[model samples]
Target: MRSDLQQILATTDFHSSFDNAVPLMTHLSAVRPNTLIADCGDFFEGTGYYRLGRGVLERDMLLALYDVVAPGNHGWPHYLESELHRITVCANAYGRDGRRLFRPVDVRSIAGRTVAVTGIIGVQAFNAVPYGQRVGQRVTDPALALRELKRAYGQVDAWVVLSHSGFEEDLRLAEACPFLDIVFAGHCHSDAYGPVRIGGVQVLKGYEQGAGFAQARPSESGWEAGAARFADASSLSLPNTLEAVRARITAIARDLREPIDKVRAPYRHTVLDRRLLLEDIATTVYSETSSAVLLNETALRAVQLHGTLTRGDVLAVEPFGNQLVSVNCPERTATSLVSDLSALAGPMVVVPSPLPSPLNAFITTDYLAGALHLPAVPTGRSLAQSVQQALTGGTR
Candidate 1:
């Protein structure tokens, strides 16, 4: 009987699920006695107080399961190199004292064969968010870094690319580069589980936030031809180590909640004011700054005008913590960007009646009126312009 090929258990976008580490480690120990576990970046960031210090917590938990780790986009932030290094040092200090904390890639011998694992931090050079707001340090060119991985392919039995570039970019990379045998993706928070063949490459995205894991093994057809599968950790009805972590999170949430003690005047809504506010936020606050805001004032106005605004509604509209960033671009570029935003605008559905509360309504009205009449002047562009172009189809 042929021995089972070495199993590779890969997870990504864990954010800060310190509780997930225990169960994941337990599962790894039981299922694949000699498996290699990898964190494909974005293992940090966007987490609440409960998830804070998760990097250190997870590293300690991985002592019994994981052997390797790769950085993701959320793993680093501006002026936070020390924080990243601190996590690595702490992880190293806890387990395998002599081992290195993070590397571009790790080459290992599994089942009597050599396997190469490469990691690349997703680039923010093309991201629409302001430079200072995007957490985690970014690599300049992910493709170029992957090229280095290609050189080691021939020497390894299997090659895996752990990426945090989301599904679309991963698909594009897989099509453009053929050497990658498997790509584990994160950052899009997509629910697509199981192995998908994209341009002859096996791509897997294991949901998000410690929801599950993806497994891959070599079949009789050989490494390149083997099939892969995904398993949902939550559906597994597995023992819940995450519950303890959730409890801790709940306590933190309660501590964060405090009554708004300030007495404020009752607010009233006005159609003209609402329209102006929406226009101002989208055009002056968002457009004037980020070149590409990925939003529509018409949609916001429609929703608010219909009395459908809610706390959750506001969050969904501006989900990303985007900052206003000024970019210099030629008039043509600015015009094209606006055209792209117009084309991208889609329909919206509002749930309440035809009136709602209005807060700080005047700021918006004045900003919108001023912006609408302002002339479009172009100047030399910056990184923000490049990012806008990338978002608006100026770049692939």
Candidate 2:
């Protein structure tokens, strides 16, 4: 046991899998009282909790926990509202008034050394977010931000940067910013297996969804790092549970528990194999719009169980908030547009609609349609609503 060595427990892209992550964080904190617990951001999204509260739930929980974090692109849509109890640092994310959203750097005095930590979100994140939602904020180049952060904190015993920037970008930043001692990277969502050294900086990243954290011990030259220990939340004695959070999540689940459809088998999700869940989505969407050439495979987020499917179960399978948008276009044009998704490997299961004409009415997401450069309008029916309608026949 390196009890004499100071440790820093870190995580990244923790999308409020707090049920699993919070306990781990608190446990490590208890064991290493002087340990610095932190996150690399993308924490304000995912799960039912995030959907219900629009980050209020996460903000409250994270702030209550007093975990240090950097901002990720997920919260750029609500920059001002996402600020936590602790100072959020990211040298790149700026305000409409040309000011930094959070502090450019946060210096923490823990154990025997002065540790300065900073954060930066990816600029590409701004492009992914809805244009309307990100009016006031701007994500500048992280490289420039790092330079500014270095200038601000001229000298420190240890310099740690909590980067929401992906691993590749972090590598580039690490090589360029020689002043950095340690970089905790996020957004890419890889465990990294072990830490990597770029130039003189020791970089680390933990697993996604708050499953685990990475521990790094200070070394004479730099730092010794390793893979994140992914621990099952159930394994912990007296596993962490929040009644208030549970009750809220439970209430949402209960509401969505109404039976949708009975499936003979589970709608399993596998990257290599096509999912039956897409067939369900395709059929439901067809029932709603009667549009031909519906595409439902690519946007899928979860898998469904066998037994009776409920709204909750269906939601678990398709968690994204994307709505079903029906648009009219030519069959040639629609097929051509979908084929443009060069990144998609598996064959897209296209379900034909009953509607006829040079106009091929189709269904897709606003974001996806924009990417395909397809002129599509929302029929105002959300993907969830369409599924619910398909299951219940609009009786509800």
Candidate 3:
């Protein structure tokens, strides 16, 4: 390793996967002495950990480990918390009063070079956040935001973006803002972990959830970037300073492992087939409720299941804790509602796949209903409960 080389360690779309927090922190701890640690966003609100701990665990990890972060749509408000807000940077997002929600930039020294770190949430990604959560918040275009930020803060050695705008958008952003040196991506959850060069910019994403991270090291041309998994860093030991954190995480893990149900056959969750599981869940809900059902694929994370499912496993599958609700939609707008939702949420599975024309109402999760601003009546059900029911074939 060159003594003058700068290194950056980054993670994105963590989505509160506390199950892997300890080891991930251990890896970060080992590299903390020299590396600049940051996250691209969506680090909170995914599993039972977030629901049970109410963001305390995730907040603790960020305070202890990350140097800087971006605000993601999943846990948009958490970024506004006083402590987190200090380290959070989002050049494009604004609050209801038309004031900027966070400071536009954070200037940091990495390997003695002045680097300007900024963040932006893509318009589509911001729209994907539940309507109620973002009632008064809004985000501008990423390219436009970057252009303005560069104009004002062009004195830095390099400009880096912690983007929750998905990868493809970042590629275009790199092209639009050629002055940016690097972009770390989040929110899409796709398999593209590119250190792909666009013009003079490098765009990349870490493995999502708690699987791994991406890093950039100074190179002769510019910077060399790539992804790495926690397993690869497991040999490095964490200093005793983090022992208490590990203990707390261990206790939480024990509680999360409590058995919830049993499955007769294994249902594997993969990138290509996660929506199939959602379709199964939607079908089960449709059968029980005798109503049409709609589900956004992003509402569930990819996790496999077999015999002896645990509470943590179920929560990991439907981490948001969204309630299963029925909402009334006018016949005239029902079709457009699904189409608009699909646009923001990527692919969606609507039970009775054709989505009958003149559809009046349907059963959907609270997140989706809130996204469309529909009045939702609680069915006294949750996506977690429905997932367990679907896997176990029980009504509960």
Q: Pick the candidate with the highest lDDT.
A: 3
Model 1 misplaced regions, further than 4 Å = 1-5, 17-33, 50-66, 78-102, 122-130, 133-144, 152-154, 198-200, 223-396
- Give the TM-score comparing model 1 with the true structure, all chains together: 0.53
Candidate 2, superposed: residue stretches over 4 Å from native? 1-5, 18-22, 25-32, 75-79, 82-86, 230-259, 264-276, 279-298, 326-362, 369-376, 387-396
The residue-by-residue lDDT of candidate 1 on 285-384, one tens digit each, is 3334433332334333112212222222232223232333333333334334445434433221111111122211111111111223322233233222
Better of 1 and 2 by TM-score: 2
Candidate 1 least-lDDT 10 residues: 359-368
Whole-model alpha-carbon lDDT for candidate 1 = 0.45
Write down the lDDT of every candidate, Cα atoms only: 0.45, 0.62, 0.83
Q: Which regions of candidate 3 are displaced past 4 Å?
A: 1-5, 231-241, 266-277, 353-355
Judge candidate 2 against the unseen true structure and give its global Cα lDDT, from 0 to 1.
Answer: 0.62
Cα deviation of 97, candidate 1, in Å: 29
Task: Tell me, by TM-score, which candidate is best.
Answer: 3
- Candidate number that wins on TM-score, 1 or 3: 3
Candidate 3 per-residue lDDT, tens place, 130-177, comes to 788788888999999889988998789888899999999999999999
Root-mean-square deviation per candidate? 12.3, 5.2, 3.0
TM-score of each: 0.53, 0.77, 0.90
